[model samples]
Target: MGTWDSLHKQHVDVFIRINLLEKALLGLLQNRATGDMKGAASLQKDFLKAFEQGMILHFAVEEEALFPVLARAGEKPRILISELLAEHKSIMEKHNMIVQTAAVDKDKILLELIRELADHAKKEEQSIPSIISQLTPEQLNNIDQDAKRLGYRL
Candidate 1:
């Protein structure tokens, strides 16, 4: 396989992590809506921890490694990366809000946050593959190294 193909496989792993976060968020939202406040609170805490460690780290790798190569390839990576960062900010705000409002009737807010996260994951899954397909082997190796430095396994 080419370098891009190998890197694309690594990106798929990131997508799996994102999907896991989405599922956790969805479960928390459901529990919140169903009056399982205790369960919701616990799950929300766990979700936040995972999000910080997993999803955030994945994005950091992409921002530091993948996006720059794509930008060098004249693929509007700057704009895409900027948009993704903005979305990450928004998601973080919503997650914090959900944690703060867990004791209150904030089921709707939780649902909205979960939905937003799902959307963001979908966008990453769709965009990264095509971008990866265009990258050279050396570019992929750089991304793999960056991901490793960021504590991600290929």
Candidate 2:
């Protein structure tokens, strides 16, 4: 496959994986809100781990490799990419807050985090594909390597 095509596939795959993680977290939140403490606790642990591994790594890859390529391509995407980065920061803050507040009413905090992450993921999925399409083969290979260095395969 061409470099851009391979990168596009990677982007789409990451989007799908993130969406799945968001859905899983949302389901956990729903279960928590319904008073399923045991179920909520179980899902909360898994969700937290996934957020750390999947979401954080995904953002790291984008910030380290993808966004720079988009920014260098043209000014048109800079603003949107900046906004996405800000949203990533916000999501990270919320994730950290939820982790910190877990000792007191962990379920409620986790539910809030899940909602915030889901909304952020939706925005990212909408914007990232277009940005990915603009990258060159060299850029994609750089991104792939950066992600690999960060311990993320995709």
TM-score of 2: 0.71
Tens digits of per-residue lDDT, candidate 1, 31-129, equal: 534655565556656656766666666666666766677766664766776788788788778767866665474555655665677677677777767
Q: Per-residue alpha-carbon lDDT of model 2 for 1-154, expressed as tens digits?
A: 4333444554455455455555555666565445555554565676678667666767776788677777776676888878878877877877878777646655556556656655666666677678778777778788777667866664
Candidate 1 lDDT (Cα, whole model)?
0.65
Q: Which ranges in model 1 have alpha carbons more than 4 Å from their true place?
A: 1-38, 97-109
Query: Model 1: which residue pairs collide?
Result: none
Question: What is the lDDT of every predicted structure here?
Answer: 0.65, 0.65
